[model samples]
Structure formats: structure tokens, C-alpha cells
Target: MPATDVVSWLATAYLSGMNDELLGDIINDVQHQGDTSEAMYAVAPHLLALSQKSSGKMALLMLIHAGLISASSQSQIAVPCPADLATEFQATNNLGRSMVLAQLAHNHEFDDFKYLIAALAGFSGHGRFGRLIEGFDLYQDQFHHALLDTPIDDER
Candidate 1:
């Protein structure tokens, strides 16, 4: 199956109430099969949508965090963060930690961003976004301080 088709299937399966472990297995199977470069771009808009919703944004955050923490085989793709959305994401209260996570993930320069985006859409209505957001809120200050401590290259 094509990567896009697999992504669509995964999204449909998850939204149709598929089990989490099963979804992960499916993702693994797909990743094992071949390259997913096209799928990466295909899923960016979906991630953008998730990032906009209060209900879905936490899932996006979690997926991004997870991808950042663990190494994934899929190639990295930068999902577009529109100017307005970028501003809103920046303005989000207590989201500094999440932003730090995103920056770290981006800097890692590996792992497909689309996978996280798909996972976010797949986890829609899962009710765990609340806990995820709460965790971020609880740790935002520490992450902000950590970010401040790290020196950024002005040249980049």
C-alpha cells in the first residue's frame, strides 16, 4: 500500500476506535515496508488542523514530544506552521515547554513530522489531551529555563 493510503487507513482505523497498540503496530509495519517521504508532506495539513483545535492540540504536542524523545526511522519533514498559527502557538499560555520540545525535535533533524501529525489526528477525541496539556503546564517553567540556558547560534 502507498504511504498516503496507509496514513489514511491509520487515521480511519483510529477514528473508528481501533486500539492504540494496534495502531502502533500498523505504523511499525508500514514503516518497515518502505520509504514514506510522500506521506510526510501529505499529512502536514492534517497536523496544522490538529494544532488549531483546543481538543486536538495536545495530541499534536504529545506526538511531537514522543517523536522528539525516541528515534524513529522515518525521514524528518517540517510541517508548516503558518504565521498566524505560529503566533498563536507562541502566545499559548504555559506552552513554553511544548515549544521547547518542538524546537528540540526540529533540531534533532530526524524522524518524520508527518507521523506525529497523523498520530495527532488519529488520536482525536481520545480524552487524553487534557492530561497531556496538564503535564506540560506543570513543567513549562523548567523547560523554559532549560531553553534559556542553552545558547542559540545567531548565525542560524
Candidate 2:
């Protein structure tokens, strides 16, 4: 599918309010088996524009997805992003950073605030921290156990 079509669908879904199934479909269309497609880069500007409009769940999801696509393009197994796309992607990342920073400045009460933080980390060029945030759920049990097992120092 063309990037414009994908962006149109995403915009419609965002306007209509997205559910998990729709998010899954969006992810599938943009990234395949953890690999980002050219269309992902192509639609990034649109996604960033939409994300800038709100700090809601759908907007955060779009930012996070764009961040993940940026990360994937840099992975060793992935193809090098085309220079034109890379330039556009970098611009999107800059705008995303500004958006996330503004969101972080506000008192966060939303359930998906952590995802916004992750997007901030990613847009700020800290891919490792971004991945940590994004994958925290996968290791939450182990992390909790580790924290519980750690010895505490009483001396202050």
C-alpha cells in the first residue's frame, strides 16, 4: 500500500478513536516482523503531525511507533535508510522531541504517560532507554523480583 493511503487510514482511525485491534493492524502495515518498511519512513511526517495535535493515547501510540521505526532502521539487520528518508526522519524526530518535551512539562495523569516518556527518550537519540521503556512490561516480573531481592542499606 502507498504511504499516503496508510497515513489516510491512520488519520481516520485516530479521528474515530483507535482500539487495540486497529493499533495492531497499523503496526502490521508499517512494520513487518520487527522490520520497518519504506512506507514507515514515508508516513512518519504525517504521524508526527498527528501526534503534535494531542497528547492522548492515539497520539502517543503514533509517536512511539515512529520512534520504533526510527530505531529499526538503525538496527544491524536492517537496510540503511535512504538519504532523503533519513533527512525527513530526522526532522520528524526533532519535531517529536519538541512535542514530547512539551507534554512532559505538564502534569501527566494519563495511563499512557510512560509511552510518552519512551517516545521522548527515543526522539532524544537514546534508543536503549527507549527500548527499555517500551519493553519494560516484558521484564516487569523479573525486574520486580530483582528489586525485592536487593539489600537495603540502613545507614543514611
Question: Cα RMSD for candidate 2?
Answer: 4.9
* Highest lDDT model number: 2
Model 1, C-alpha of 130: deviation from truth (Å): 25
lDDT score for candidate 2 against the true structure: 0.66
> How displaced is residue 124 in candidate 2, in Å?
1.8
Model 1 over residues 37-136: C-alpha lDDT tens digits? 3333333333333344323334445344323222221224333433544444323222423433454455432223434433332223221332232222
Candidate 2: residue 32 lDDT (0-100): 67
TM-score of 2: 0.68
Query: What's model 1's lDDT at 90?
Result: 27
Residue 96: error of model 1 in Å? 13
Backbone clash pairs for candidate 2 read none
lDDT of 1: 0.37
